[model samples]
Target: MASAQDAGRGWSMAGRCLTALVGGYAAAAGLATLLARLLPVARVEATAWGMILSFLFYAAFGLWAFHEPRLARVAGVIWGIAIVTGGAALLLGVRP
Candidate 1:
């Protein structure tokens, strides 16, 4: 029922939206972790979660771009989970 253009458009929108959210978080986290030493009071690195959040964010975008609602939903859930506990894991060095 869907045309190729429609599919492509859908995917593009998904990718754009997902990237905006996830990419923003990843950038901020990276800056915080890497720049922590800028101040004498350095904060703990949230580097552990860096990989998962970055991965899931792009994965969700890619999945949604393909119009795979099921997979996109799964990825969205994972993204949510990652955001919720990602910082904790990074702080504690516990892999999620």
Candidate 2:
């Protein structure tokens, strides 16, 4: 039988994985949209760069989620960033 500590660790790992997958993607998408909208470069170039940079953003955020000691704090910060950036993109009329 699995010990209580092992089960708790498993649950924590699952939560971190979920946060990295979902929150990372959300944050990356929001950042890309914001960058594409705010960049001073040409629209095509801006969009291209934004899309390219999104992969890096996702990876970085995923790593951060895994490294964080507190799952709740990680989730809160990641989701907060995603929500704020998404709202900013919408308010700025980013269409992509």
The most accurate candidate by TM-score is 2
lDDT of 1 by residue, 6-67 (tens): 89767655654564466435444543343332324414444444433555545554455345
TM-score (all chains, Cα) for each model: 0.35, 0.85
Best by lDDT: 2
Candidate 1 C-alpha error for residue 43, in Å: 6.6
All candidates' lDDT scores?
0.48, 0.89
lDDT of 1 at 7: 90
Prediction 1 global C-alpha lDDT: 0.48
Q: After superposition, how far is residue 73 of candidate 2 from its true place, in Å?
A: 1.6
Model 2 residue 59 CA deviation (Å) reads 0.3
Model 2 per-residue lDDT tens digits across residues 1-96: 336767987877788888899989999999988998899999999999999999999999999998889999999988888999999998978454
